[model samples]
Target: MSALLRDVTSAVGDVPALLAIARKAGTDAPQPGQGRTARLWELLASVAAVDVAAARILEPHFDALAILSQAGKGPGHMDGAWGVFAAEGPGSRLQAKAGDAGILLSGSKPWCSLAPQLNRAVITAYAEGGGRAAFAVDLHHPGVTCEEPAWVARGLREIPSGTVHFSDVPAEPVGGENWYFNRPGFAWGGMGVAACWLGGAVGVARDYRESLAAGAEAGREPDQIALAALGETDRILTAALQHLARVAARIDGEAGASASDAVETGRSAWSEALRVRGTAAAAVERVLSLVSLNRGPAPLAFDEPYAKRMADLALYVRQHHGMRDDAQLGKLTLEEECPW
Candidate 1:
């Protein structure tokens, strides 16, 4: 397997291990402790510590295919080195025009993760007529080429998130124009990203907590300052986790009740996604800062995994819109009902 494929494979493999540990330990995790509910959070945090971006990419492919299946689109799943490059950008353009076979995607799709290694990609492209659409395209097609030296970044360089150029590449439509976003799963998918963010924070925090606990034992005295930092982070993480559980419950309860009801309830799920994403981002930033302060520069500078985890979390959080998303969340707040 290619290095990219191995990286993704290793990152995803950690999910089940963490959940198993969490469940067997009887964590009673502050969030819903029952069944898959608590296990979900455990999985995200565990995998993210290993590889943040890989964890971020895991849930989306299946979520994308599941959405399509519900839309009467396809029953196929994207296996191997795959990515969902549905985000539109002007830098590298992707245009889809309908033709004899099905559709043709030409131009470049930028920021496609695992580009060179990707066997397939599910992308969002501008249709020839109007509106945005989603499609499944083969990366190895004669018309497609993954740009060399994919990207430059302070972190996450291993994933190869570069541009994929397509020239008259045959495409298979997954959902109608705008159908990808219109589906309730789109927002639900957005919320899933937050889970990964929170998971990465947990991984970072775990190191700091272990470091502090060890120090406390060796010194035969607790360092109040470091302990305080850990305490604060725990509070923030607990609250962020609880909020995620509520949002997950909302998606599960509504979509499970009736698929048709999903359309009407999607907006609420999206609104919650915005809310939880912002919450998780802020919590992560706060926790990471405190953890670094408590542990100082040694772990970050010397320990490869520790440093990478810190850098990875820092970069991944910046990928999402911060205040802009929060502004949208403010508007959404008017639409939701609260116990207050």
Candidate 2:
């Protein structure tokens, strides 16, 4: 970790060191024909190796920074720590309204990660008439209050997950009415989360790798079934890596092509994100499940890193909506195939 990166990311546990390492390694410009995808994966892999929760906490910041830096549509008030809070559910939640008091946010923002730590957030609140709108709100304002953490899971305790109550907090609109979600980078950001999932899977797999390596050194051959399971896990991960590369290439091509066609660009980015997210989640789930079956509960019971990584990876992959998301991807993919 470099001194500068340490300084920049020190407030967030463990991420500064990983970011410093990535900076030292250097990455190509995020353009087509450049190895920017590899660089992204490189950073993600390093973060996952150290801590999955940290990666989860850090990725949104990376995405938010990229989103704002690439397109400075956000207001100047969002100059501090930022996150994207846009999870709308079938239950009660926040409502964004406009009145004499300026744009106001009321209700609870659920699943607001790093809610206690963030000073600013690029939030999506339900528009008054209909649809969604993104706003840059200051979390430090008196209207905003962090509630008790809502996560009871065994994984990702380091990344706080809870509801943030907004009691008519003032906010500045970001871009067009739906510009934030409409932006191409929205789904690309999802891919970044998948990248973290990929890294966490790799970290968990390291446990088996070391175990196998020790066996190899002793001139011993493991059972053929165990070896076969390992091989299958490797194949799954390899497939996911290739998918990521392809998605990155497509995104790079889009970025280099046009600045006007944001709708098409967003569609393409989301299509790629949904596709790769499905593949990557399945691959990670498979690797963890198979490895757990092959090795039994010994590691989970004894090894701290491996155990945590295993738990973390299991929860992280749930970012994908499973069959529903895959179904959406299939429909979009088939529609794209037709030359209209």
- lDDT per residue, candidate 2, 199-291, as tens digits? 888777777878777887898667898789888878888888877866675555544544442224677667767877888888888888889
Top lDDT hit: 2
Residue 330 miss distance in model 1 (angstroms): 2.0
Q: Which pairs clash in model 1?
A: 45-199
RMSD of each: 6.5, 4.5
Name the runs in model 1 displaced over 4 angstroms.
Answer: 1-42, 73-80, 254-264, 334-340
Candidate number achieving the greatest TM-score relative to the actual structure: 2
- Cα lDDT tens digits, model 1, 22-138, are 233222222221124335554555556556755655544434444545557533353343457876667877899987877899888877876555567678899876888888888
Instruction: Please state the error at residue 114 of candidate 2 in Å.
Output: 2.0
Task: Report the C-alpha displacement of residue 275, candidate 2, in angstroms.
Answer: 0.7
